[model samples]
Target: MRALHIILFLFSFLFSGFFINGQEQLTKHATDSIEELVQKSRKLLADFNIKESLDHTTKVIKYAHEINSNVDISRGHYFMACNYEVIQDFSNSEFHYNEALKYAELAKDSLWIIRSLNGLGNVYSEGYKNLEKGTFYYNKSLEIVEKSNIKTEKLGPILNLGWTYIDEEKYDLAYPYLLEAQKLAQELEEIGRIVAINDIKYLLGRYYAGKNEIEKANQLFNEVIKAVESLEIISVLTDTYKAKSEAFQKVGNTDSAFYSIKKYLFYRDKLLDEEKIKQVEIAKANFSLDDFQRQLDATKKEKEYLAKIARSNMVINIISISLVLLLAGIFFFYRGYQSKKKLSAVLKEKNEELQEAKTEAEKLTNIKSQFISTVSHELRTPLYGVVGITTLLLEEQDIQEKHKKLLNSLKFSGDYLLDLINKVLKISKIESNTEKLTKTPTNLIELSRNLLHSFEYQAKSKSNELILDIQKELPGVLSVDSLKLSEVLINLIGNSTKFTENGKIWLRIKILSLEKDEITIRYEVEDNGVGIPEDKKEFVFEKFSQVGREFNKSEGTGLGLSIVKNLLEMMDSEIHLDSKEGRGTKFHFDLTLEIIDEKGENELNPENSGINQKFRRILVAEDNKINQIVTKNLLDLIGYECTIVENGFNALQMVQKEDFDLILMDLNMPYLNGVEATKRIREFDQTTPIIALTASELSEVKEECMSIGMNDIINKPLDKNDLRNIISKNLLG
Candidate 1:
């Protein structure tokens, strides 16, 4: 009996230990499964598949709860909360965050708790705009991180707090947090530190811009733009460029402003296109996933049915049936594979076609741009002479009244035609995405006053009071696209003056922000005349649009506001309209400029600014008899002793033989082109200035002239002022 009892005890102990080991293995497997699910959820979140992330987290939570693992449950809830926050489901985000925190507290997991707090903070601040509530949670998380040795998660709350303050316009309060975050970000090894630094600079730029330290702001903005552009951070780069444009415009650098604005638009549009493509891909992937799920379900059900049949059937029959099912499965899978391959090929072909179409469209656009540019240049040359000669003739003392009146009409017609041509070219350039900004030093106050003054007579005709309100202590000289700025201002002021009758028209300019070398300016053209109707306001900016067709018969091409809108767009600005019927309209916009320490030479006085008094000979090259006469007459008027040449060959021959001060070589000539002539002349007479007279506004022509050793270039149909200025700049220098 003692031997039996000992044996029984041994057996029981062996059985119990085996059972316990098996249970332990099963529990480990379950835990591993939960972890795998959590990892998958994390990957889904990383890919921004929030719905899938939520579903995976939900499964993870269910599995964790079944296993009674508090830590894993907390992780599952945390992931769920993050997904909810991403989807902007604030209520669910808050609930899951609280649940995560509860489980984390139960598990005594500090990291999970900190994450939950941070998530809650994000939900309140970014989603609900509850800054105080968000700050409280962030502070709690920060406190926890400080107590712990973990530095990886430290910057999150700090950055969040800083951005929150920035959005609230509390720059003073934002800086401390941003600075701290910037310092902490450098110590982080896992994330890219250089990108982090640039991001910090981006925020700092905005802060300084808000503080009216435009120069400092621009420096920071530029740094960010340089780094982020190379990094291809499209969203951030777009915002940075836009901010930089605004900063430049403030200081009156409309050229830089337009350049920056174009960059911003390019990146912005690229981002949008990328997002659209991603959405399409996602839709396709989702459809494929659904199809795969259905196929998997069908295969599983087929397998289950086969297994049941195999269990009950004879051996030979079971084998035969199994073989048939295997063959069927193979056939179906092969068919499916072939279908997928065909679909892929079709998609590829379609993509290729799309690429070809895009290429063709871009080619067409370039052609259109070039055609318009060439035509505009050609037209401007003759128009310049017509307007200039007509004006000069009108000023003659011995002319009859009727002749003078007719001359005035001819001048008016020429001016109107020139305006029409310019407007068309501007519109074409914009449409073809070929407009380029040229920067030069400009006086903002003087430019504004000149624009306002130009419209004074027109205002008086309507018995309107023109008021100029400019901010005091504003910077005078700024680098800007003077032409575009003038165009925008003229359009806005002209529209206001024309519309307002027997009322007040105010041209107001104020400083939006100022940095050391950069500034943002706000301009307002307000009128209390025949106000735009609420319904008609939207149409005012449309091309060929007129405001209130029934009330007014204004003799305009209706391109003023339309041109203003386009010009402002080029300058990275937008027009804001506020108007009421019978009351008035206020058109507001903003521009950025870069302040210049010294004025540019282009700021010439029209009356006395000319070449130094010297009896110098000039050679005029031309292919047309009419242009030769016109050129000679204009040169005579300016007291320049000029010798006329019929073409580029004669001009080149004359320059090589005679000691001429300057040569105006025509580009399109009979034998040798101006470019070749200039090249040939440079071989022998390199000292004399060879100015190419071309009827092409395209910069390529200018580049061609420069490459062939030409000293300067003058466009035809040129203004007398432009000609004189060019002459003084090149010859006098």
Candidate 2:
């Protein structure tokens, strides 16, 4: 059954188109305009618009050696990394920082490499919030500072580390670094640094105050005020006053507390105003980029207009090229035809050859499936141990709080491993021609949110931007399984995020039409990533399909997008791609939004509305103790009644003697498993629902369940939600 699910889910890939279909003119001016955009970015960098400068640096690096500029190449990567850090894109910043470091090493510039490493460390610390790695870089930067005494240059890393410690709430640990940073700031006569140092001092006072060292805390705060007065960095002077007020208020001075609140607001407003100006500049830079791209597109259009004759000649040349290829294909076809004629005379020989190959392939496939099934089950056992033991370990009285966190991480990793194994099994099933989807009316809004949260971590890792426009305005839920739709979106979003760095992706919803009886919702995932080539667009969404190797290679069974296509088609929806070679890509699809009557909705989602009034008690007949434990846990979570019976005969005896609401009879039990027991029970009672729970991949199981008057069918690995949903639908209907 699982294998069938995978195969059906991947079948659409075999039928999807294999080439780009949009009609557009390719022009020369667009080419030149793209060039000018690159050139202009170099000038912007030189003009001190450093962020804008960094944004276009990669375009120049694309032609680094051809343009004969090693210095630019090294500087470009370094500068781009610095900009990425500003926008909180730690991964890309680290990646580019490493690139810059490599180029700097090739250029034999220890100074630049040191700078790049420092930048890398800073990004790790602030952007990714990785203090340990940040400390490593700061210590290295401190080494350089100690040797050269580069005045204010070394203070950045030291201060960053000190703040990191402050975040950890370790005042005693932070003091030494803060004091050293303060000394350096004073020696350099930097007013901004001096003010920041005072702020840390005030933080120390607060920390000590909380420790009940009242006098010590007051003394520290007094010294911080004096230090701030000495530095006279007016921008932070108001904050100093506010801190002083808080210190006084802490000593039961209400008047001072009110004064501090006012002082804080004054400084906060000033800081916000300054930040607003910087943000405006950033907005302008982004606007300029968009405007410039449009201009480039226009230039390409003009070039096409000018090169009309050249384009005609190019078309003729392409036709000639096609003719040559066609002739070559004909030659091969003739030879193949002659071979087929010979094969016709010895058809039995050919059939035998095919038979031998097919048998060998089937044997290999069976062995592969067996190997995967065994390994996956083995791995699952350990993961379950980890999850269970970790759960128990977390409850220990002697476990340190910090160690508790480490245990949580361990459990999360275990679950992650189990998840990966399941994904591999799913992909293997799809590849082996065994997959299917349960057709149903699924609410897509809820589904989209689930997938979004799931892939939030993926987008975060790439520093990729995601925009969602799905809203409740979308009517009529779609005819699809929410879980399957979520899986499809996860696959698409994961791909988009991976292929693009520091770019935006959008999952938008548009209602094409809405009526009382029907609604159509368009769901599209768009990304500013490496787009498909004109000739290879549709080929990308096929089974085992992957794009250009040179375009940021990814490793996975290339079945994700293909599975999405299959699942969507089964639900009677279409997925599309709109893109150019270098611009980006957008995926579009529409789903039939289902609208159920108000009363029907309540009946369909009984448990969801907390309106299940049917029998809550259920009897589960299972042979495996592990399965029993899992079943009990699921039942407890959902607030249900469950009693476990080891064998079918025991379950039958229990049912014969007592009234049971529902019997979750498991097949392959020790004595007279599900089907036979169900038959015996049905002879006496016809009203009670019997749900078959099994691990078999037999088609006859569903038929057998129905023949014995069983309410529904579900296969195992212990699905809790499916159990609840099935039971609800059965009782409600």
Candidate 3:
């Protein structure tokens, strides 16, 4: 039932030999001696001989410090922390865990550091009931495990996190973690990790019981009890019975609860017999007394050593005074010259190494960028066909109602996948410093109104009221990155709508300061919804972090707020949040922008103005068959006749053979790419419009498309409206 307690025993047995193996560089005899002490200490601890274990661990620490072995020192302190935790001395457990962490970091041992962090987490979570601090340490441990790809070491932190969430009665939050732990436990079971298997089974039983799934919970509990009984894991047996009793009580099964409680009491008493209890008490008293005596003895020895050093230094200094006078400036100059020459040579060598490293790093970065671009194109190509087909199907008027519902769901999923892909690529670009701000003339009030309009369907679905408030004194237009600003607002507003139901959400814009050339405007998105907890505020902006995942599990991929933070920072602004639980949340930020034109045009334009229905011939150049079908169908929907070509080379031939109003050229095509084909076409026909259709990132190809005489570019997994608008605008020009 308690993962921390169960994992503590496993940690001892698994890591007992870690320090011994790490000290292989020492003398064989010394290593053998230390190894024996470590093994004996662990055995005594396992056997419940607390005093004997402490004595052996103390000796190990002394020997380790004398030999200056940080690995051994950390091991000793970690074991001491475990023993204290077993005895419920959380203060001492916390102190020793910290000390162990310090030495583990000094030794550069990641495994020991993770162990120390988990130990501290257990002290806070299990002993003190401080879930916040406990969750922090557990997350830290998991972060290290993930970064290091230590598959074998990830189960502890994951189990502990699930256990903590269950303690908070947030069963929804605990479910995913417990399921992941169950998967990991099964993997470990393949390698014969019996303890982990039983621990996960027990924790999962508790989770099911908490969720009122009594039958499933009882089945899991029965299996765990059978396994732990066979293994003679008395502590686990006691904890399981206690949890089963509480679960039965929750369901008002008084007779079963009573039976379970009796079993729990029996096991608890068996695990801690009266004689064992007396011995543990006596051990605690003796440990305190011995600690005091050891401190006194150490103080005496330190004073005596310092006195000896003082006398030795006094005699050495008197001799050094005479020696210095005899040696004079020649020795000093020679030593200084040699030292500078060695230092300069070392610096030069280091600089050469740094240059080589920089070159290798740049090479790797380029490789990563190329890989991402290739993957994006490959994924988007297929996704475009799916999304396009789904859209076309949904537009059919004679479809069955049930099938229409299914199609809508399919469309939602396709759109979600496309959004996830775009966000991921956006993150990659930002992290690589390839994302740049393009400051364009923008209407502030109109942009805010349009962003709110975009979320109307979502808001209505949630039964939430959407409000936009803009100060009259604000300028009509400002020089800003409207694309990035829209992205940030869309994410924020979308989150508010997703988390709030039958509540009011507001997008407020205020002029903080107005100047002749620049104005500082504050933008706020506030919602009366389920707000974030205080402990989770700092992590809201972390990548892939979902604060209210338990409330809305399927809504987001947890990248929105992280993208918002990065984009705002790029624009030289910061986002701030204020919220309380069960009330509301508000996110605000301020940006100072240059006034482009005070009386800028703020006209609202319809997305799809009907284009002329004149007989116009269009050329479609694409390599994929599915894309060709989807594209041709789309153009057909818009009442345009299209000629299809298998590649850019074929498109060039077709264009030369006949006159066409526009050409939709796929960027990556066989025989000839869009860029090359566009160049060839420009040499002959300069009047016809050529539009680049790419599955690659638009930023990567936009400039090249323009340079190659392409009029515009559209990303794949494209929206139908975007396709229509681009085609219409290009044809008009």
Candidate 4:
């Protein structure tokens, strides 16, 4: 049974393509050509063209090396070993078999491992007639089969074991295994089962004859002869005829035994001729190997001759060039020194001017950042009042339907305005190089699906469909900055929604490849929108540049794709754009994420609870009165009462005299700013959560707040949910 398994396994290696783990990295045509060459080699071997077959097989091995395919190379080695075995070259056969085993294990191919084991067993049992070593190899092969529970071709080794015992004259030990092989072979499909059944029957007949059961042994031999006569398996028929002759002679039938002996001798002579032809084939194959080795030696000798000639020419050239180079070196050294003296003064003047320009640029950058931060804070303070008041008003049921609609519209506008402000500040922080990416274990498929579900409403409003295509084999979790990933997806999908109407948008995430601890995935957002013009394709990634299209005539700050580009670049990736006029647009990028353990989920994901969790007392520090009202009311809505102070200085004094569980210290306050006040407060009170509450989007200020012992920072105009979450997390911690 194990022999049958090994034959089929070897058959596959000869006839089919070998698969490398990363076969996708190879071009399809290259893989196909290699497979074709291997199959061709199998045909040549079957036709007894051993020399040509070895040629083709060795070509495959070389090609496999060119492509760096360990599995294919293993298949090549295994086939070459089979070729060597056919030539009666047991030494070379063993060497190639061991080589095959080495690479098969490297390729993690269990079936190939079994094939190598069985082949080695045959070399010991049939070639060297070493029963002990043969039994060891056969047992190891069976262990692999049993462990893997592979039933398709397990009869090969059982049959081999039966034969090994029979050859050693242990008929009793061989009978049980041969019978088992017979039963297993009957379960197989037609032609192969027939061949295997006849082979096993002959072995069982030999065993019966050894036990001196002449009648049973003769009956079994007759049945095997009848089955294999038309099948033309010369070896089986010859063995069966000889065994029947022995049984007849033991039963004292001289004439019948002589007839059977004559038949056996006829087939034996034919088999001998076949063996001679096979030896001739082996000689031709050896000639081919010798020819190839000679060619390699000739090429090596040619290379050595060429090297000798080149070395001889090199001495003459060096002697000719030394004097010229020495004169040239002195002239260049003097000329270079004279030039350096004049260039040094000019370089010094240029360096001073360049330093001044760099300083001026830095100063202007600071000024622009400060102006944006200040304007953002001022706008957020007023917007906070508008949104908070509108939210509180919407909670009242007595309002008329028209007034309610107006209030809803106003609130939507305020929210949109706040989003625009946040985008501007995000761009500022990114340009200033102050934003940091924090990685966590996240299920990207779940994250992508959840993000798509969130946009269902917006997609429906435009009569568009959001489609999600995620690879089923994608790993459950990866270490990444999920917040940034979500933001990038949102921007891309949001852009699709804005420009697309009555169409479909697809968000596709698929695993590209997985190596050891890192998996690369490709994310694509595609939409059948009025695509951007070719001229404006590059322009759209620039900040605040919208493509000139009718569908894109709607209101947008145009910072969405720019922010996506920057964020991806920060993560060491780039966003690719593919668009065609009036067709569609596709934004895709590849990201490689580190694999993380499922148990580390909680370690990577912090709990963010939006439920109201109020403390005993809260402090509100702001210079703006509307901001104070908005902050106090927002806190009160969440079941906390806060004392308002006019500025950081007043808040600092009040904090020393009064007790508060949390402080929402505004960063840009009058008198003493939030950084100073927080520093002073931390000097005495380090236990309370001092959260920096500001509309400024500068990461520098956030870092400064943390440096002064602030626990967290929340950007405004803040959502009620964000405020609740931040407060609960900091206060409870």
Instruction: Note the residue pairs that clash in candidate 3.
Output: none
> Could you tell me every candidate's TM-score relative to the true structure?
0.55, 0.42, 0.55, 0.49
- Name the top lDDT candidate: 3
Expressed as tens digits, the lDDT of each residue in 1-733 for candidate 2 is 1111111111211122110110011111124443454446544533324444554665555445334444445656765665455434457678888888788667655445566777777777665668788778878867765665544456556766676676566668777887776676554334344444565666566566656576777677768756755643334445455555555555765455445544554553454345432332242312223434554564454234323323534445334433443453344344434533443344355447557766887788777866776677666654555664665566578999999989988976865675566555655555555556555666566667656766776678788877878766765455556656776787788778767778888888888888887787788888888787898887777666778755658645566677777767766787888988778988888876567554444325545656453347789998777767777666665667789999999998999888877788887788687888988998999988888876544233666689878888775554456667787777655
Scored by lDDT, model 4 comes in at: 0.74
Q: Taking the candidates one at a time, how many backbone clashes does each contain?
A: 25, 17, 0, 10
Q: On a 0 to 100 scale, what is the lDDT of residue 158 in model 2?
A: 72
**Rank order by TM-score, top first?**
1, 3, 4, 2
Tell me which of candidates 2 and 4 scores higher on lDDT: 4
Query: Which residue segments of model 2 deviate by more than 4 Å?
Result: 1-344, 351-411, 428-433, 450-468, 471-473, 481-483, 493-506, 512-521, 527-559, 565-586, 590-599, 603-616, 666-668, 690-733
| Per-residue accuracy of model 1 over 1-733 as CA lDDT, tens digit each | 1111112222232233422332343344357778678768866665555546666787788778766777778878887776555444567778889999999888776766777898888778876779999899999999988887556567767877887787788999999999997898667442346555766788899789878898899899888878767756666787788778767766767567656765765675575457432322232211234444655675465345435444544345435544554554454445445544554464466557657766887899889877877788778777867876786686578999999979978987987887777777777777777677778788888788877887776777789898999988788788888878888878778787777788998989889999998999898989887788777878889888887566667756888788888878878899999988888889999888898886453565645754553487888888777677777777777778889987778877787678988888888889887888888888877688878887665444766778888888876665666677677767755
Model 4, residue 420: what's the lDDT?
Answer: 90
lDDT of 4 by residue, 226-306 (tens): 887786656677778877877776676756665676587567556545743443333432233443454456445433433
TM value for model 4: 0.49
Q: What are the clashing pairs of model 4?
A: 1-155, 1-156, 1-157, 1-159, 2-155, 2-156, 2-157, 3-156, 3-157, 4-156
Quantify all predictions' global Cα lDDT against the true fold. 0.72, 0.62, 0.77, 0.74
Give me candidate 1's TM-score against the actual structure: 0.55
